[model samples]
Target chain A: MGRQLLSILLLAPLAAILVSLASRRARIAEYATVAAAIIDLAVSIPLLLRTLSGSLIFAHGYVLLDAFGVWVILCVSIVYALSSIYAVGYMRLLNEEERLPTFYALFSGFALTMLLACVMNNAGVFWIAIELTTLVSTFLVGFEREAESTEAAWKYIVVVSGGISLALLGTVLFYWGSSFVLGPSYAMTWAALRQSAPQVYPPLLLVSFLLVLVGYGTKAGLAPMHTWLPDAHSESPAPVSAMLSGALLNASMLGIARFLGVVTGTSVSRFAHAAVVGFGIFSFVLAILFIVRQTGIKRLMAYSSVEHIGVQALGLGFGGPLGMAGALYHMLNHSLNKSLMFYGAGNAMRAYRSKEIKSIRHVLKVFPVSGILWLLGAVGIAGAPPFALFLSEFTVLRAGIGGSYRWVVIVFVIFLIIVFIGFLSHFRAMYFDEAPEGEIVPLPFTAWRTLPMWLAFLPLLVLGLWWPHGLWNIFHQVFLSVMGGGQ
Target chain B: MFLAHINSLQASIFSSLAILSLLLTFVMLGSHWLKNYVYAFAAQSWLIAALSASVGYFSGYRELYAIAVLTALFRGLVLPWLLMRIVSRLNVKREIHSVLQSSSSLVIGACVVMFAFVIANHMSRQQQGAAHVVILALTIMLSMKFLGFLMLSVRDEAVSQILALLVLENGIFLGSQILVPGMPLLIEIVILFDLLIVVACFGMLVRFLVVHAGTTSSRELNRLVG
Candidate 1:
């Protein structure tokens, strides 16, 4: 079951890409991606069920699921399934036919690489997979073939690639330190690094931690190093942007989490915390500032990622159950809300063919379902009541102040308001004003697209309104296990 | 003792050979000719290969020979050949109206080279290794590209821009190659692949600049500045 399930996750996308190569049948290509997504989503369901029961299937060495990997993978698969469906309708409107085939293939490639990255237990393997995702998605970011798109892709590649390079260097240095503890023969597995942290060389470990923090932090879209996020996210197709903002960023975050777990020994954790705290506050403030001044819908969301990643890193840095849970929950909530927003924004882009915020208005009058969904996503992301993000954001704030970082809490509250306003400014322009001066056509909502949205949004509504015990157990187990007996 | 003195002198000679390649980087900053820049880059790679060979002897790392030979073949031979083909096709002469005057560019080049030395010096204080030396050497090469970019940004010629690009590749190859043992092999290969793709993309950028936009230098970066 372990081999089969893992093979299914990895091979399904390759199969889709293989089928996509046969004839220029965009219909078949769309169906293939959607089918691949469904298969991946279905596979993740059993894993999720097992995880929720506090019985996760770990196989292929450390590559198996405990609680944390289970939820993170499930989130990725769910988003992948939805984004593929969204892509079908999204691709139909593209003006260029020449790059469509490559785009479809690359999208599948990105999913395959990200899935492998999410599941890998070995740190080196995980880092390589994340870097591979960057490579595969570069073309997607540049899918439009415009100079701005190319420039965005170029900047994304150079910045992230360089950052990941530092990540590699950091990984090597960390492993070099880990060698002293584990006796150099053992591979640098996540379990080994965490389990054997006491013996790791403190000074070497400190350098490694700083390197990975800066390197992966940049890829995670944290501030001071987040120069690539807005342009890359805003310039790509809305669905591509969705995957990037929703899922890819999280995978990198997960890698950083792995780095944090092992690197933060009792002696060196303070250094890690200081770096995380400094960058987290800076990123949150910068994201708010950028979002407040943004004119483009996609660009606004990109900056919002900077904010969310800040929250996530801050939670990890705080290092307790409440903080970790809030961070994990925010990860999930942001994934759902951001993907939904991108889907809605995809529709708006189709209708208006413009990403400019002012040009798109009265989307509810033109497209009722998408406009409402977009509003819900925006509100959910802004930490509206009963939404998981509200719980996560609030808990994180409590963690910050309880930990005596009152200034962080203040900044967090203020930025939350700024982001909320930025989102609402677009939402109001989108749904409450005059109808857009653009053509309104009934979009090609492939069953893939519509089904996933219904699956995703309805559950979001339910979860926001009530708490599920099974999920609570998943987080509880995660809090107990993934934290490695730490607070 | 006699043999030790001879080896030290040999090492210094090998390093001085490499030093000439680093000097080649500066020569391009003040120099104007495309042929001169390309020739200088080729010489830079040869010196890098030679320096690696010297390090190999000192460290007794046998694999450095293969690396040295590969550098000569790929960097010194194939790349320069490609650049010559491009140079002949474009029939470009010299870069005069570059982004900066030779005097300013020379000054900026010195500052950048000094910055590279400082970074190298600081990093060596942490843990001394060949990696630091290689990174600093590459930094010098990269500073040339940065200076050339300032030139390209102000200058108006596709050929100069491409020459600047070739200089940039010298830096990348040095950095990527030297990042070894400290960096994973996968990353080094990926960096190489990135270099190749960026070259292709820049190739296309140059084509568009020349055939469509009627400008090749980075100077035409005005229309989108808002």
Candidate 2:
């Protein structure tokens, strides 16, 4: 059953993507995504239950049948399933006969790459998978096919391609350094590299950490190199923007976690930790500045992505159990809140044909469900109490302050406050003003569109309210694995 | 010190030739005609390819020799030839408008070269034979970046910007070969593939700019600025 499920998990999305290409209508392709997602979830369910029973499943050398990847893959598949259902309702409203099908095709293809990036055993293949995510998403950024979107696509293409190139270079460099350890057995697999890492050249490893930090961190949209984030996120389709903010960024973070694990070993771990923390503080500072100045609703959310990613980076930089858990938890919450924000943006624009903050007035009046979701999303991201983001974010901040990184905690609090004020101003105007003049009628609001959002949000609610049994242990194993936990 | 001298001498000759091509950045600022700018770019590539060949021959790295020849053929000849056709057929005159003053840009070019030389000197002290090579190559990269930035700053011509960008890419390939030798063949091939596709994309972008905007200038691209 495990072997069969693994093949299905790998092949199902590719099959859906291939079928999506031979047609103009997306109904069949969207259904295929839903089917694939459900099947994948079903397949992963057993892995989760078995992991709980203290048994591990391994597919290939690189593919570890561990609790960490199983949980990530399962969560990704579930969210994807929900998003697929929503896409059916979403695409029914689009008039681009040729493009809508292509959109669905790329969407499914993105799911395949993300899932592959999740479960792949070799860290090198994992980097390639992350690069594939950018390559596929470039089209999604320019789906509107306008000049502005073209510029946005170029921004995404150039920055991300440049970033990933550095990552590839870093991976190869690591191979050169690690070849000293595994000799002819060097496979570029995570397990091998970690096991043989003590012999890893320290100076060379330092350089590798720098390269990976800049490379993967750029994709993760850390500041100083995150110039492309706002343009690409704000310009892409709402759902695509949601996925980018939600899952893609997390995937890149996972790449960084792997880099830290391999490079640091059990020793000082100083270089990787210092560099990531610096990047985190820098991102937090810049995200607040950009968020306040932004006029586009989607751009505001993109900058928010930068800020939240900073929290995750801070957690990883700290490298303690609490910090690691908080970082992982924030990954889940970020996907939920950011995707929800973009859905509201999508629905708002569908009704108003504009993303301008001033033009999207009275969202609640026109699309009641999306309006409330948008409000909740805004509140959540601003780290308002009771929302899931508040919990994860608070833990991150607590970790920082408790660890005596007072500066990081202070800067974080300040940035969160600035973004909160900015969101309030925009959120107030969006819900209270007169219905946008000349707002479009008959926008698509399929019940399926709401499923992914709800699925994403549900975990946030559950995690925030109660400490789920076994989650902590899974988090511990994953964290330790990153910190070279268990051999 | 003897080993260092040889490296410095090698780097000096290459950098001097590179500085000679820094003239092209000025030409970009001062020149009016698109033809002259493309000519300046062509001359820069020719110098770059030649310099790369000499560096490879001196270092005895045969693969770099192959890369150098490829650089000369594709960048020196192919890219310039392509740009010539793109401009002449597009019917845009050679006397294109620019963003900064030719004199000022020339000054900036000199500064960038100075910075590159200093950086090259410091960098050369680290690697056995490749330090000067690395520094000059990095300067060439900065020069390319400066040239592209200048184009982006002043002129609104999308075609010119894209052309300058390809030239800039030539500078990057030049540097990468010098600082990072012994890389896996796969990476080398991937970089080459990436550069080729990017150039083709630039070509397509130029064609589209001409078709849709009626001119390849960014002034016409004012449709999306915010």
Per-residue lDDT tens digits of candidate 2, residues A278-305?
8988897888877777778888888888
Q: Report the C-alpha lDDT of model 2 over B1-226, residue by residue, as the tens digit.
A: 2123355677777778766766666676567677887888778777767766775677555566666666677777777787777777777785345556666766766676676556435423344564454456556654555555555456665556655555555555555444443433444444455555555655655664454445566555443322
Q: Which candidate tops DockQ? A: 1
Model 1 lDDT per residue over B1-226, tens place? 1112234455355446645766787787778888887788778878777765664565554566666676676678766776776667666677756767877878877887777565444332223333334445435534544554454444456555555555655554454333232223343344444544444554554554455444444445232211
In terms of docking quality, model 1 is incorrect
In candidate 2 chain A, what residue range of length 10 has the lowest lDDT sum?
A51-60
- Root-mean-square deviation of candidate 2: 5.4
Per-model fnat list: 0.00, 0.03
Q: Tell me how each candidate scores on DockQ against the true complex.
A: 0.13, 0.12
lDDT (0-100) at residue A3 of candidate 1? Answer: 52
TM agreement with the true structure for every prediction: 0.81, 0.79
User: Model 1, A179-281: lDDT tens per residue?
Assistant: 5455523556777778776666576577667778887888899988898888888878987988898788888888877777775555777777767777888
- The residue-level lDDT of candidate 2 at A466 comes to 72
